[model samples]
Target: MLIDASSVAASADEIRAGAVSGIIFDMDGTIIDSMPSHAQSWVAFVQNHGIDIDVPDLMRRTTGRTGAECMRELFARDMSDEEAWQHIAEKEQLYRELFAPIFTEVAGFKAFAAQTRARGLKVGVGTAGDRHNIAFAFGHLKLPTPPDAVAGGDEGLAGKPEPAIFLEVARRMAVPPERCIVFEDAPFGIEAARRAGMRAVAICTSHDAAQLAGPHVLAAARNYHELIESKFLERLHVEPA
Candidate 1:
């Protein structure tokens, strides 16, 4: 988790001009430290069902996908929404159970979020997690300030790499895509931000920064602590709160 602070700061030219007005975030790995628990739950779920599957491959294939999409991809079958929910619900419960004890935010996430808002940025969350997952996370995270808006996968929207989810969040925040910056951890989430005409900050939690990088990526850091140390918000010239 050794992030190059200078390189991270030098890429913030887009933010330095006070052009960005909104910040959208991806949840699981980007905000909460839940990816490892999600992975473990996937393994246990497969084992409990006596299914033979490569957990790592499954993670890569479905990490940023919607619940229905994950079910369809995992089984290679076209499932009705009802069927998908039935299956995914059980797995999600397992994830919640496994993650509850270890529920924690990425280092410095709360402070950074407060700082971002204090600098006059509207914060929102656009995550592939379903409503239940969102509720579960928020219940545990108890963030000092909740996001101004949140769009989840259960909204019948396509997930990451499609840009629909992030676009929906931006629409809710009333911020033009070009004026919003997405904070994401997965490659698909980063690509979704790019497709949505938004720039992004890569959170190197579940994947390597290289895997998440793109022309629209403004910064990459291991956690909010690194971003704070690098003066990420301080460098951004934003409106007075």
Candidate 2:
């Protein structure tokens, strides 16, 4: 991984030489600090419903799954899409209410995304979050501009740990998967990037670096600020496309 100056510099050189043209960010923990709120919402949702489920374990299991996938996994049963979304909407509404007052991006996330665009790298979001959650995050984040492309969970793609979501983002960006870099905060996302044949940079917002580590991971940082400190952006030599 790009943990030191030389390695970070080398990876930048490799990136430039590799002609990496697109960067896909996982929405929840990578772009915004929403994981904690998600966890809290789950606890509240279950408590309200008088369910005896293990919330933390549920979070661990469902972190990178689609809402329907999460619901099915949570209850360990197959569910119609309409039935799944009904539950998902209720839980996510709780999440939005809990998160709205405290919404914040990972440190330097906006600046990092802006820098990528300035360097001519297309920025996209590949997220397990559904469309409503996407709107919720953006309504609060207020990025300087929207991503070049976005692939949300509600679109029927299999979620992280599956390459479909990230691959779709690459397709929408009109960039080959091998020419994209995925910024992710979960182990499932790192694996998804690998499956998509894209390089990965782990944003360790919730999980430990060890949990997110993989051969495909070029770097792991607590936030974009650390990546900036590593001078990663400065070494990128991509020009406007």
lDDT of candidate 2 over 120-166, digit per residue (tens): 89999999999999998988889888999999999999988999999
Q: Give me the runs in candidate 1 sitting further than 4 Å from their true place.
A: 11-14, 239-241
What is the TM-score of each predicted model, taking all chains together? 0.95, 0.93
Evaluated at residue 119, the lDDT of candidate 1 is: 87
After TM-score superposition, the amount by which residue 165's alpha carbon in candidate 1 deviates from its true location, in angstroms, is 0.5
TM-score of 2: 0.93
Q: Candidate 1's error at 46, in angstroms?
A: 1.3
Write down the lDDT of every candidate, Cα atoms only.
Answer: 0.88, 0.87
